[model samples]
Target: MTKTDLRHRDVAEAAASQPMLQQVERWSAINSGSANLAGLATMAGLLADAFSALPGELALLDGAPSERVSASGQVLETLHGRHLRLRVRPDASRRMLFTGHMDTVYPADHSFQSISPIMDGRLNGPGVADMKGGLAVLLAALSAIERSGAAGSIGYDVLINSDEEVGSPSSAALLADLAPTKIAALTYEPALPDGTLAGARGGSGNFSILVRGRSAHAGRNPADGRNAVVAAADLTLRLAGVASPGLSVNPAKIDGGGPNNVVPDTAVLRVNFRPAGEEDVRHARTAVEAAAASVARDHDVAVEVHGGFGRPPKPVDPAAEKLFALVRECGRMIDLDVRWRSTGGVCDGNNIAACGVPVVDTMGVRGGAIHSPDEYLIVESLAERAMLSALAICRIADGGLA
Candidate 1:
C-alpha cells in the first residue's frame, strides 16, 4: 500500500477502537418513537450534544406541519420534534450530505427499552440495529476524518431527523432544501444482516381516506342511512384490485365504526402503496383517487383523501454507481467485501436522490430483525463499519470519489 493508503488504514484502525457501543447503548435507552414528541425532544438534545464535537454550525430546526386524518374524520396537523443540523464549510469545492434518523419504531411504553447480549457477538434492543448504532458509526467516521487533517477539503451537512419511522413527512422539506448543494450523500441506515447494502429502493406512500355518511338507528330507518363503514370496506377491496406486477397495495385498517345499534356514519381507510418506479407512482395515485370517487358515488358517501406518496423510487443511476464503486474500493482497502442489492424499503435517500444527488444510504452496523423487538447489532461491525465509512470519507476527500 502507498503512504496515503497506510495513513487511511491507521485512522480506520484507530476509529475502530472508539467507544461506539457505549454511545449506542446510551442512545437506545431513550424511547424516541415517531409519535412520541417528548421522547423525540430528548433524543434530539442528546444527539445535539454528541454531534457537537464535530466542527460546524449546529442548530435545531422546527419540523413542518404534517397532516393526518384522525378517527373522528377531522384533519389534524402534527408537528415533529426538532431535527439536528450541522453545516461545515458550506462553500467548499466538494459538498456531501450525511443523514440519519433519531426515531425508532418502538413507542414510549414499549417493553424493549434496554440493550442486552443476545448471542456470541450481538446485542439486541429497540433501536440497536435500526439506527442508533448507525449514528454512532457516523460520529466515529467523521471524527476520524477530522483527525486525519482532511476535513477542510469537503463540505458536509449532517441532518438527524426524528420522524423517519413514520415516513419523514415532516423532515422531507429539510432533505430537499439541502439536496441541491450536495454532489453525494451517505445515510447511515443499518446494513442488511449479511452486511450487504441497498441500492435501488421502491417508493412508498401512506394514505387515509375518510368516508362520511348519514347515521341512523340500526333497528329503525336503517335504509335511509348511508353506512360509511360499508363504503370504506368496498373501497378497501377495490384498492386491492389496483395491485399489479409493479405495484403493491395494502389496505391496512378501517376506523370509525361505532356501536352495533347505529349505522356507522364515518369510516376511514388506512392504506399503504409501494411503486416500483415513477410510472407506477403515477398509476397508483390515479387508481386510488378513481377508486375513492367510485366508491363514494356508489355508496352515497362523501370521500376525502389525505396524504400522498412522500418517498419517490431511488434508482442506482450512473452517478450513484460511481459512488458505490468508490465505496467498494474503500471496503477492499480495509479487507472488507462490500455488495449491494435492490430493496423495497424507502428512506430519506429517496428524497436526496430525487434532487439529483447520489446516495449510499445503508452504511451502518450489521445485524438482523430491524424495526422489531428483536433488533440486534453485531458487536464486531460497530468498529468494522465505522472504519469502512471513515475510509470512504477519506477517499472522497482525497479526490477518489469525485
Candidate 2:
C-alpha cells in the first residue's frame, strides 16, 4: 500500500476504536426535545462533558430570544435551552465549522424512550439515529484527528444547538454569525439508511397567520358577525392552492374556535412552505401575502402574517461541488463509496449554506425512519462514518480544499 493509504488506514482504525456506541446509548437515554428546556439542559451538560476530551475552549451560550404565535393569536416569547460552542486552535490560518443538533423530535413524555438492538446491526431508540449517534461520531472523528496530530494547523469551531427539529428559531443567529468565518463546514445530521447523503436541499419557511374578526351572538346577529375561523380556513385553502411542482405548501394546523352560541373572534393558521430556489421563495412569500389580503377582504377580517423563511435553498454551486468531491475522494480512500441526492428535508446545513460556506451536512451515522418512533441507527456506522469524517477533516486541514 502507498504511504497515504497506510496513513488513512491508521486514522480510520483509530476512529473506529472510539466508544461511540456507549456514548450513543448513554446520550439517547435523555430526552432533549426542542421544546423541552429541562431535558435539553441535561443533554447539553452531558455533551459538554463528553466533548471535553478534545482540546478546545468550551462554553454553554444562552439561546437567542425566540417568538411564537399562541393559539389565542397572541405573540409570545419562547424559551430555549443553551447551545454548546467549542473553539479549537482559533488563531490558525485555516478554519472550519462543525455543527450538530442536540435536540430530537421526541418530547419529554414520548413513549419511545428506550434503546434496543434490532435486526441487521440496527439500534432502535429516540434520537439515536436522528442525531445523538451523529454527535458521537463527530466527537470520535475529531478525537481521532487530534490523536493523529493533524489538527494543529487547522482550527475549527463546534456548534451544537438545542433547537433544530423546530426550525432552529432560537439558534439561527448563532449559525449566521459563525458560518462566514469558516472555509468549509460539516454538519452531523444522519445519512439515509443506505448511507447516502443529502445534497442541494430545498428551503423551508413556517408562518402563523392570525385572523381577527368581530364576535357577535350566533343566533341573533349571525349575519352581521364576521367568522374568524371561516376566514382562517379560507386562507389555508388559498395557501395550499398556490403549491406547485417546485414549491410545497402544508397548512399544518389552525387554532381558534368557540362555543356554537358565539362567533369566534380570533384564529391562528399555521402553515409551512418548501421552495426549490430563490425565485420559489419569493413567489411563496408573495402568494402568502396576497392570499392573506384576499381572505381578509373577502371575509372582512384583519389578517396578520408572522415568520419568514429560516432555511434558504442550498444549490450545488461550484464551491459546494468541490466540497462534495473532496468528501467522495475521502470516502474512496477508506474503501467507501459516498454519494448524495437532493432532498426536501431542511437542516442547519441550509442555514450554513446561505452564508456562502460549502458544507457537507450529512456527515453522520446511517439510519432510517427519523422523526418517528421507528428511528434506528446502524450501529456499525458509528465507526465507519467517524472514519469518513476524520479522514475528510484531516485532508482539509492538510490544505486539500485550498
- Model 2 weakest lDDT span, ten residues long: 1-10
Clashing pairs in 2: none
**Model 2 lDDT on a 0 to 1 scale:** 0.93
Residue-level lDDT of model 2, residues 1-402, one tens digit each, is: 778667767887899899999999999999898889999999999999999988989999999878899999999999999999999998988899999999999888889888876677999999998899999999998988898886778999999999999999989999999899799999999999888999999999999999999899999999888999999999999999999999999999999988999999999999999999999999999999899999999999999999999999999899999999999998898778999999999999999999999999999999999989989999989989999998888888878898
lDDT over C-alpha atoms for residue 347 of model 2? 97
**In order, what lDDT does every prediction score?**
0.91, 0.93
Q: What stretches of model 2 exceed 4 Å from their correct place?
A: none
- List TM-score per model, in order: 0.97, 0.97
- Could you report the Cα RMSD, in angstroms, for every candidate shown? 1.2, 1.2
Cα-based lDDT at residue 266, candidate 2: 97
How many clashes show up in model 1? 0
For candidate 1, the per-residue lDDT at 250 reads 94
